[model samples]
Target: MRLSVWRIKYTQRSCSFLRSFHRSFAAAAAAGDDGKGCGPGVSLSDLRRAPACSGPLPALKPTDSHTVLIRTDLLRPGKAPEPHPSPDQLQDRWDDTHVKLPCSEHNLFPTDRTTDQRPSKALSVFLQGLQGSEAQHMFGELLSAMAQLALRAPRLLTQPIPLLRTQRCRSITLSQEQVSCLLANAFFCTFPQRNSHQTEFSNYPDINFSRLFEGSSQTKQEKLKTLLCYFRRVTQQRPTGLITYTRQCLQRLPSWSSSEKQFGKLHISCEGSIEDQGYGMLQVDFANRFVGGGVTGSGLVQEEIRFLINPELIVARLFTEALNDNECLIVTGAEQFSRYSGYSDSFRWEGDHDDQTPRDEWQRRCTEIVAIDALHYSQFLEQFRPENMSRELNKAFCGFVRPGVQPENLSAVATGNWGCGAFGGDKRLKAVLQMMAAAEAERDLMYFTFGDADLVKDCVHVSRLFLVGSVFRLLLQYYECVCKKTTRSRPQKTLYSFLSELL
Candidate 1:
C-alpha cells in the first residue's frame, strides 16, 4: 500500500514539472528580447549564429578499420579516389623503385648561395627546442617533401602525394602567411630514406647498408633490456617481463593552432638549411586546409599522386656504396656529423648503421645510411663548409640527385596539402606562392633559382609515404567491408572479415 502511494505521488510531481516548463517556454516565446512582446515573432537567427554542434562535430571515417579518430565536420572536399591497392599492387610498386637518372645533370639552386656566411647565433639553438620532441621526426617529413617533388616529377604523372605533419593549432589558425614563410625559409639540405636506393624495398637488410630496424634479432629478454637502457631507467624484473619507455597518452586540453607569431610575423626562415652534398631543391607553399586527392578527415586518410616524370631522369642515392651500377645510392645520417671541418667514419663508417666496404668508391660514398640527412632539420648548423653545404643542397634538391632507372609513369600520394586547394584554385600554387613572396627576398637569386633546382631526395619520405598510402588503401577496403557487414544489428562476415583485425 505504501509503495503504491509513493508511485502515484512521483507521477504527479513529474507531470507538474513538465507543465511548469511548458508554461515558461510559452512566456519566453511571447516576449521579445526586451521582454515586452513589442517585436514581431522572433527569428531563430540567434540560435543559427551559435557555434555549430557545441563541441566538435563527428569526424568522417573512410572505413571501419582505421585505428585513428576522425571527425566528419573536419572533412575536406576531394576526389572520390580509386580503391586502395592490394598487397600485390603495393609489392609491385615497391619493386618499381630503380636508379634511372641520366649521368649528366645541372645545378638546381641559385649560383649565389656559394658565398653564404655563418650566423652570429646558430642552427643548434633554433633546433634546441625541437630535439627529441615529438616534432623532431619532422626532419624526415621535410626531406621527403623535397625529394618526392623532384624525383617523381609529379607534373609528369600528375600524381598528388599528400604531405601530413602534426603542428600546433595556433600555428595553423593564427597566421597563414607565417606558415608560408616557414616553408619558404626551410631550405632543402638532405633526403634520407630506407631501402630507397635499392630496386626493391625490404624490411631486411643486405650486406651493403647496415640495417637498424631490420636484420637484428635479440631474445625477448634482451629486447627488454635494450628498451630499459634506451629509456635510461631501471625497473623490477617482474614475472611477466621487462618494462621500458612505455606510457599512456593522457589528453587533457584542447589543441591550439600551428602558426608561430615569430615566424609568421618576421616572414623569414632563420631555422637553417641542411645542404651537405650535391643536387636537389624543393618548391613549397603556404596553404589553409588541404585534403589533396582524397578525403582526410574520414576513416583511412589518403591522397593520389599523378606525376609523369621520365624514369631515366631521376637518380637514386644509396645509403651505402652501390651494390651494382643499377643499385641506387642513398645518403643517410652524416658519416661523421659535426659543426666544423670534416669528420671521419674510421675505416668502416659507424653510428646508427655502418656501411663498411673496401671499394674506393665506398670511401666517402653517402650510401647505406638512413635518409634523415636528405632534408633533416638538424640541431647542429656549423658543420659543413659553405662549399660542401652548397654541394649537398644542390645534389639532393636538383633533378639529377639520384640518377637511375625508373618507369615513365612515376607519381606520389599521401595526406598533406597545405591548403593550396583551399586558398587559391591551382595545383601549382606552391610554386606560384614562392614566386609571389620570396622571389624578391633573394635579390640576385631571383634570376638564378628555378623550382626544379631545389629538391631533397628522402628515403624516409618515400617509405613513410608508401606506408601512408597503403594504410589509406586498406581503409577504403575497410569502409566497403563495414557497409556490407551490418544488416540491422548483426555482423555479416565476408572473405575479408578478418582483415580489419589488425593494427
Candidate 2:
C-alpha cells in the first residue's frame, strides 16, 4: 500500500514536465529563436562594423549568420551599463583615415590565391574518434583536434570579423557558481610558511589537492595563456550580459569577519587591508596537488609559479551576487593572467562595467621577474608534456571530462541551418552533427572546442591576444593596484612585487 502511494506521488510530481513536453518539446538549441525582426525566408548579411556615419542604420535582413535574434538590448536596463572604450570607437592610426583594418594590424587577411587552402588532416582524424556516450568520453581528443586545426587550410580555419574578435561561452548552461569554480580550479596556489615560535599564530592552512591536467610541459607564461583560453571559453555558454566583464570586489566579506575560525584556521599572512583574508590555504593545497596529477612538489615549480602568480585565490564562498555577476567576472581573465605570469600582456576595450573595487590602485602594486616575447612563448610547452605535447593535451583534457559528467545541455550541429538559419529544435540537431562529421571526414579537418583557431588568428586573434597581453602589461605597470587605492603623504610600497623572484 505504501509503495503504491509513493509511486502515485512520484508520477504526479513528474507529470508537470510531461504536460510541458506535450505542449511543446524543448528547443534543442535554446537560442535559435532570433525573432526580433527577422522573418521567414529572409537571409542575414554579415554584421557591419560600428559605423562612423551619424545616420540611423537599416533593419537586419534575415540570413544564416545574422538570422533572427531577440534584440537583447530591448530587455529593460538592469543598471546603467558601465561604458568602457570600445575598439570600434577608438582613434584610427595617425597615418591614414580611409580603407582601414577592423583591428590593429591591416595586413591580416590573405589576398593571394584560393588554391593555397588545404584541409586540416589532424582535425579530421581527431573528430572521427570523438564518438560514444559520455560514460567513456575524453576531452583531450578535442584539444588535439584544435591544435592540429591550426595547420589546416586558412579559409576553413579563418573566421568572419565579429565572430573572430569576441570570446563567449559556446553553449549556455553553466551558472556563475560553475564559472567561478572553474576559475578557482585554474588558479595557481600558494601557502604561507609556518614559523617555529608561533604554535598557532597564522590561521592559513596547508595547500589542497588538484586533478592533474595533462599537456606538454609549458613555461609559466604559456601555461597561464592556454589555461586562460579554457576558462574564458567555458564562460561563453549562455552568457548573461551581466557577466560580460568580471570586476574586482576587494571589500571584506562579513562571514569571514567573525573572529572564530571554523574549517581549520586562516592566517592573516599579508598584512594590511589589501586582501579580505590572507589565504584560503587548505583549499589552495588541494588545487595544487590536483594540477600535478595528484602528485606533490615538482622541485622549483611551486616556487616559480607562486612567485609569478597569486597562488592564493580569494576564498570562494557560495555567495554569488546575482545582480553583480557580470562586473565580478568582467576583468577576471585579466586578473588571473596578471596574477601568476607577472607578465601582464592582457588588453581589452574597457566598457562601462565597474564595481566598488578600486581597480587601478589595487593592481599596480605587483611586478614580475622574467618578461617574455612572442616567439619564445610557444616554445615553453615541452616541460608539461611527457612525450608528444599535443597528444598529452588530448589525453589529460579528455580524462577531466571522461567520468560521469555529461556535456550538459549541449546541442549538436544543425544541417539545414548550414550557411542559413538554425536547423533548430527538430531532430535536425543530430543530423547536422553527422553532416559536419561527414564533411570533416572528406577533408581530414575538424572544427571543435571553441572552433577554428586559424580563422580566429587572422580575423580575431590579434585583438583578443592584445587584450590578454594588456592585462599582464598593466600588472607590471601597477603592481601597486593590488595594494588598493593609497594616497598617503609618503610614497607607498609596490604591491605586486610578490612576483619579483620566481616566474
Candidate that would win on lDDT: 2
Which of the numbered candidates is closest to the native, going by highest TM-score? Answer: 2
Question: Tens-digit lDDT track for model 2 on 68-119?
Answer: 1122233222321211122233433312211111122443434322212222
CA RMSD of each candidate after superposition: 29.7, 28.8
Model 1, 1-503: lDDT tens digits are: 95467446545554543444355345544553542222211222211110221123233233322211112233222211121222123211111222111111222322323212111122233334355753354345533443343332211212111111112010001011111111121122211232233423232122111121222222211221222121111011101110010001112211111111110001111122212111011111111112111111111111111000100001111111222111112221112111121111111111121222111111111211211112222222211222323322232222112223231211110111222232221212222222212111211011111122221111111111112122222323333445334553323442123332432
lDDT of 2: 0.22
> Would you estimate the TM-scores of all the predictions?
0.15, 0.19
Each model's lDDT comes to 0.21, 0.22
Against the correct fold, how does model 1 do in TM-score? 0.15
